[model samples]
Target chain A: MNNSSSVIEPKTRPIRKSKIDYSQGPAPVSVNPAWCKACNICVALCPQGVLEPDAEGKPVVAHADNCIQCGACWAHCPDFAITSNYK
Target chain B: MSIAAKEAGARQDSDVVLRYLRPHVKFPNMWCPGCGNGVVATSLIRAIDKLGIPRDNVVLVSGIGCSSRMPVYLDFQALHTTHGRALAFATGVKFSRPDLKVIVITGDGDCLSIGGNHLIHACRRNIDITTILINNYIYGMTGGQTSPTTPAGAHATTTPFGNTEKQFEACDLARGAGASFIARTTVYHTTQMDRLIMEAIQHRGFSLVEVISNCHTYYGRLNRVGQATQLLRMFQEKASTQPKDPNMVDEDSKDMIQTGIIHRDTEKTELCDEYQKLTDSLAKGKSS
Candidate 1:
């Protein structure tokens, strides 16, 4: 029991999660072409196949309905090109 | 609400990370398309934003390497110093101005090899500086040379047959050197990376967060790993959340690296604070 006092505890955070209200339907996913280098990472990582690569390997929002707005693509985009509308 | 108000609301949702970047730092950055450095930089910006630290009060110092190029893209008081001396320069900055938060961004070769002495002494001094050592295992900038942290069986340009030396566990090295706080997380663990960086910054003494990033352009191609996505998936599969003894030679978790805080000691004295006390006592004795 002496070790109990020394054990580190994970900090508690506010329970609120996700800025997008899912009840309002799926949010829009936009890709900024200027910043995008056509890495195909967002297309490969989209869990629902919401994004598809066009002729030049650039990611295009092909199936917006499939987007759960889980932010996997948003968080993994190496170029910071993808953004899920939080408003 | 009118369509105009809705459009305004949507525009604001573009990207919260852009507010932290300099307006003129070019698009797409200098790293390879799927390099993990970009992802690490994004997490860092988000962490800084969450802390609400004023941009002017933060200083970013770096030494020459792919990871050291971070200061060029990030909008902060930046200094791109010589190779392997980022921590030395950062220590000077902390001593002169104790009010600012100094962060050092370095790579595997820069921190563990040439800068090895500085790393140990900085940890020993326990100064209030946060170091983010991005360990991608190989020297990506110099064409995939095997670094000190590269695994024994891993292949690099310098060691095509296979690296024969045992890897340096960076977190254990920091702990042994007397760092007050130490944490490790991969680029695959974005949320954990953000939380650990925030915690490391808030810690009162010397804090080290070794970020295991992907150098897909060099490390991945040399090792026959598919791409950045595949490398990230490998990290997700290989890393364990539980803490393990670095010294132990466990067979079950031999391939796994621990994520989360590895060690912490808050009672250790910070160098600058102790120096201030010494100066105060000296002045009082002179007056008496």
Candidate 2:
């Protein structure tokens, strides 16, 4: 009986590279800074460490290159200040 | 770093194939030119790559649909089962071989409409499987027919007059049914799709990814978003963040609904975990 339990391996190995041009710097996250109340939710929740606090404690893109464009920061931001350019 | 050194590094890395791939599976999938299933398939493969989960330890299961062809293309232990029974089959597979990572690729019609019972029970039981529901909003394989996730007033073979029934939000339904991880992403956002799939796979209990895909051949033509590019553009524009209150409307949004991971809770016990506990208790009682 060919038990459906046989283990199979991936036929091809994929290369590790960012699909987007990260060298071009962080893609700008469209934000209305004025609407941002510095809740810091974006900074705290960002898994990629993309956001950082400015001198006024406002969230800014500290490491845009690392942003995987997961949208977690944008989704969690209460103020609706963050958006991304999928284009 | 020097420019020459950087260029050399890039060249070296570019040629190296992913270590996780099985090497026997060939490229150039069977999906049509504009089918979004290819994109979703790539994202799943990429997620598998990122996690470095041994290909031998993962099992891909699917039902009848364009997306269901995913298992055939990927070099893995795949079960292309009957229409609307992928979850049921996957449940059996996971319970029997707990060591293997099981993933279910189902279409809206195949899953929600026909396999709704299995989907509901899978969530309620908190099965340890990752389900990627590719919702192109219509039955692409059997011509353009209305699906459970087809937006209200959308055109389809059966709903040429414009569908009047409400759509099923798969992620919301999964969350309501007690799924541990629920995420929603579109084919336009490939990077986010990859991240979400990786996270969902790592989650302990049942994980659902309601991937809004584009069916340019049928669904797009019927919906008036004719071209693949147009459908992708529309998804980018209309899809917004899930609001804190499900009822809260986005004032600037043209469409009332939102996208992105709507809900995720990891504290719940998985079906396998609970089952093990029950068996252990029974054994202890018998011994005592």
What overall lDDT goes with each candidate model? Answer: 0.83, 0.74
- Pairs in clash, predicted candidate 2: A10-B21, A10-B22, A11-B22, A11-B23, A11-B24, A11-B25, A12-B21, A12-B23, A13-B18, A14-B18
What's the TM-score of each model vs. the native? 0.88, 0.71
Indicate the TM-score of model 2.
0.71
lDDT of 1 by residue, B91-141 (tens): 999999999999999998999999999999999999999999999999999
- Candidate 2 lDDT tens digits, A41-86: 4565455666776666567777666665555555444333466543
By TM-score, the best candidate is 1
In terms of lDDT, model 2 sits at 0.74
Q: In candidate 1, what are the lDDT values of residues A1-87, reduced to their tens digit?
A: 011111212224332333334456544688888888776667666666667777766778786656656667777777878877643
User: What shift in Å separates residue B127 of candidate 2 from its native position after superposition?
Assistant: 1.0
The positional error of residue B160 in candidate 2, measured at the CA in angstroms, is: 1.8
Q: Which CAPRI tier for candidate 1?
A: acceptable
